[model samples]
Target: MSDFQPAGDGSGLRVDLLAIADLIEPSSRVLDIGCGDGELLHFLSGSKDVDGRGVELSQAGVNACVSRGLSVVQGDADADLANYPEQAFDYVVLSQTLQATRNPRQVLLELVRIGRRAIVTFPNFGNWRIRWRLMAGGRMPMMGNPGEYWYETPNIHPCTIRDFVVLCRDLGLSIEHQRVLDGAGKAQTVRIGGSWANLFGGQGLFMLRRP
Candidate 1:
């Protein structure tokens, strides 16, 4: 319904969504948190034959996914994840939604508890432009494409790549794979806590599991 193969690239996914799909394997059971319009689920079902389920916060989003024949339900991420059973899924993905949650740490715990592996992605709050904007303007920074006003934006408690790494270490979550994507939306080599990712990377994606 939403154009499954936008560019004939086989996945019909956006830059970020394509990357997230690449991290998933064939025929895996996946639960997508904040799965905006079920684009990823649609793509996965077509390309990977995955068992995909999604939870979205908006009715419109849910409707869109349903129209595409994806299994999706409307729900709040911060509260709903707690109701899912332990290790019920092979993979749980929280793509670019970490910062918007009411309690990221608790949500993170639930992610690992509900799935054997958790894939998380978020915009890097430590991008130099974000830093420069706040420092230069003495106010909360405008962000993302066609950036929104500080007070009106949905993003709350945004964190950096370094900050996320620290939190994962503190929580004892195993980071099986990690990537820092730059402004062009391409992943770059990064070492945990290294200055490059903290200073220049505009986004981060990570795969986690409990040890």
Candidate 2:
């Protein structure tokens, strides 16, 4: 980890975000979509020596990021990204926010178009806890960070690691690396994920590149 400490109260960065940053090459330009308060971008810029910028729709999120001297734009992921030419950045990141987008595939294509590589992370809807909750209790599983009332949930495209891999195959995106996080965001016990791990892993992160 870089010596640069996060600006705000130590909510600390999310483990998944840290994991993604760990894979990034030093001095890369990064664009973080749905950047929230720019915590990850700040860390990347200050600690990892990355040139980082963000796009966030929430006014409060943008303001908070700006207050910390971060560069962020107010924009929606669903909109066109024509302003950015092909491969304008070394990396484009969409962490734990892909499921909330109006169109996941389109947004992903744009990310790859605007950057040489993309990192995406999201909750695994196929986790065993979620499956058991639905099977045994007949209820949508409330698990980990995604635990929230059904009516108020932000996830619109709940899917598993396998699902994402399949989507990548179908969309012609090449996945360079993948990682699954346990409930604590630590590496899961299972290393080789397939059908079994896909149904049990809590969250997943992917590093992708255009074919």
Candidate 3:
């Protein structure tokens, strides 16, 4: 049986974020890159007593996080991450934001360098829904939202789960743990490293560390 648990109902977090929280240890020092409105940081701070900090690109998002009393700064993951020293935090998280980074490889390197471990989550371009839509309609795929057009989407470096795994291997990063999520962002009971998961999983969640 899979150890993945269903995200708590009404946890005031997106299912994916909730799952990420579960992967964290209580009282840890955390840095949430591309934290958006600091939802994960806030939740971790309150529930897990984590000493949470955040970096968000959007000014509005920084404002929102600051208003919520989260220790967040306005910064870009692509460039600003280099300023952090090695092993500065217990965990560094990038959730659903990898595809949007200008240089994902550099950002990922920075993640593992700055934290003992890194937690990453992103929509899987290899999901069957995306593949079907692209093959059938011959247009760029959309993830259940008709309003989001291909050109307008922020995902510039869209990648499949397999691509991510290969990148991690190439970078010499160890996969501490990994899980697949279903359409509702709930963790699924599937072999996350298998082809079946690449075909059916809606998203990929990973815990990574350097060797």
Candidate 4:
């Protein structure tokens, strides 16, 4: 394994967000969709020197971001991405929000349409623990990150790494870079068109762009 990871400042950002920050270039324009409290936006602005902006679904989140002096507005991804013109930013990021979206494919289309590169992350439904829970106990695994029961959770369409790969292919988005992380938020060895990443990865992060 390469053990290559995104740079971090020990700012208490989630491992995935730190990973995302590593992918972004300096002085670029960034739009973070579903940016809860603008942690990633704040980190990117300070660490990468990017002009960062955010779109949040909750007023609480927007208020938090604003308090932190980050440019964030209350908006929903399913409804607002279309308002932006093409390639308005250098990078557009959506972390842990794709599955909860009403139309994941449509949102993805808009991501690449509005930014030169789109960075995305999601929980992996095909992880071994999740599979074993379903197979052995006939129950869905409870995710700790969001900490909600399956019935109470808002993720309408949970998907795996393999599923996302297929969707990206269907959408004709090129996968410039991808990372599969274990439960501890460490990167795993990449294996494209293989089941290892799907079977073992607890979370998946991808960088995509239109051809």
lDDT of 4 at 183: 63
List, residue by residue over 135-175, the lDDT tens digit for candidate 4.
Answer: 99997777534457788877888898999999999989999
Model 1 pairs whose backbones collide: none
lDDT of 4: 0.86
User: Which pairs, if any, clash in model 4?
Assistant: none
Per-residue lDDT tens digits for candidate 2, residues 1-211, read 1122232335477766777778888899999988999988988888789989899989999999999999998887888465778999999998878888888989889989999999998888888877888999987766434447666677777788888888999999999988887654556767636776787777788889999
The TM-scores of all predictions, comma-separated, are: 0.92, 0.89, 0.94, 0.92
Q: Give the TM-score of candidate 2.
A: 0.89
With a 3 Å backbone cut-off (N, CA, C), the pairs that clash in candidate 3 are none
- Supply the TM-score for candidate 4: 0.92
Model 1 regions lying over 4 Å from their true place: 1-10, 190-192
At residue 41, give the lDDT of candidate 1. Answer: 90
lDDT of each: 0.84, 0.81, 0.89, 0.86
Between candidates 1 and 2, the one scoring higher on lDDT is 1
lDDT for model 1, please.
Answer: 0.84
User: What ordering of candidates by lDDT runs from best to worst?
Assistant: 3, 4, 1, 2
Q: RMSDs, each prediction?
A: 3.3, 4.3, 3.6, 3.6
Question: Candidate 2 — which residues are off by over 4 angstroms?
Answer: 1-11, 80-82, 143-147
The local lDDT score (0 to 100) that residue 15 gets in candidate 1 is: 63
Per-residue lDDT tens digits of candidate 3, residues 44-142? Answer: 999999999999999999999999999999998998998899999999999888998899998889999999999999888998888998999998886
The predicted structure with the larger TM-score, 2 or 4, is: 4
Angstrom error of the Cα, residue 173, model 2: value is: 0.9
